[model samples]
Target: MNLYPINAGNFKLDGGAMFGVVPKSLWQRTNPADANNMIDIAARCLLIEYGNRLILIDTGMGDKQSDKFFGYYYLWGNDTIDKSLKKYGFHRHDITDVFMTHLHFDHCGGSIQWNKDRTGYEPAFKNARFWSNKDHWKWATQPNKREKASFLKENILPMEESGQLNFTGLPELDVLKNSALGFDIFFANGHTDKQMIPMINYNGKTICFMADLLPTAGHLPIPFVMGYDTRPLLTLDEKEKFLQMAVNNNYYLFLEHDAHNEIITVKNTEKGVRLQEVFNCNEVFNLI
Candidate 1:
């Protein structure tokens, strides 16, 4: 099996929102804000190549939204899914599975695209089976007022319309049973209901996909949860449990939204679980 970090692009978000109630004096040290106070964020996806399957963990926000709509997010950079795939000599059609961590626009927007005629939408990965759990599918489709803005219909419904949508059977105690992807999925609800975090066993190491649960190394502190999370208190409990597990198991965290850091490991310290080391995808896996 081979794993590659696919950088879709970078965008800007309010640092305050990203850091939640964490004081700017603390988070700014790790993620400095611009004059407008927006911090740089990467729509970093993961590519897993194993046997006949080429699975993509998440697709960054696609280029289908109107300029006015995109202007709010401050999208930047030339990196795209197409360019990233080409870098590895792969194409969208080569993907056999598109595993979404959640249905947020930045996480799943690339799942669909405008058709050639621009009359309607179509699945972006024509050959891949789009995966989302039953509960998340319902939650996103019937979005709550708070999360409605993040779960856009265009980024979601087309996958089902194209007849490639599939749901992972509800897991017992958040452990995905009988997964075809060769990873154990841990369900996290603090960020959003039934958000799946894939625990990948690679070359004698376990890599955890930190999808908004840990966002960046700076979020290692227990209270540093994002404002976007629906339940901040629940997030604290989840983080405590997960961080302890990460430290105990020596799990390498694959950060999806951290622009500068690709992968990180944590160590139990006096303060709490703290960042141990940061490495690129190849740097960590290649050594193993």
Candidate 2:
């Protein structure tokens, strides 16, 4: 199997929101914020090439939102999913599967796009099957007060309307093997209900797509949960278990939102799990 890091786009989010109650003075050591108190965020999606299938892990926030909507995120950089795919001799239409970690706008927004005349929204990848768990599909469609804004209707629904939406079978425990996307999924709910973390076996290493579970290396600490999480306390427990497993199994964490560090490993330190080392896609998987 081959893997590539597809940078859909880059933007900034409030540091406090990203790091939760963690003081700026502390988080700034790793994730330095701008004067606006915003930290760099990457809509870093992963592309998997297996057999004849070209599976895109998640599409970044698509370019369908209005200018005013994008102004809030402070988007930067010239990267787009099409450009990133083309860099590796692929295109958006080549994607056969789109496995979203969750239904958040930033994660799945790129899955849908505006039609030619801008009359209605449609699936961005016409030939791909969109994958999200049944539970998350419901939660996102019937969003709660806390996540209503993050789960935009335009970013979703279109997949189902496109008649390409498929629900992966939920695992009774921590891991769901042989998912529709052909990878094990680690189910996490602290950030959102049934957030699927893809665990891909690549080049003799377990590469875990760390969605919001550990957005960046700075989030290695257990208490550094995001303020956006619906259940911060639940996140604490989930992180404790997942981090311990990562250390024990030596999983290569593929960070989706960390702008600085692309891939990293965690080791058990005196203080708890901490960043072991940072690696490039070339050094780790020889993506090029």
lDDT of 1 by residue, 132-210 (tens): 9999999999999999999999999989989999988778785785487888898889999999999988889998998
Residue-pair clashes, model 2 = 0
Which residue pairs collide, candidate 1? none
Candidate 1 lands at a TM-score of 0.98
lDDT of 2 by residue, 1-288 (tens): 889899999999999999999998999999999999999999999999999999999898999999999999999999999999999999888899999999999999999999999999999999999999899999999999999999999988898988999999999998999887788999999999999999998878999999999999899999999999999999999989998999999999999999989999989889999999999877887855
Q: How many clashing pairs per prediction, in order?
A: 0, 0
For residue 9, give model 2's deviation from the true position in Å: 0.5
Regions more than 4 Å wrong, model 1:
none
In model 1, state the lDDT of residue 111: 90
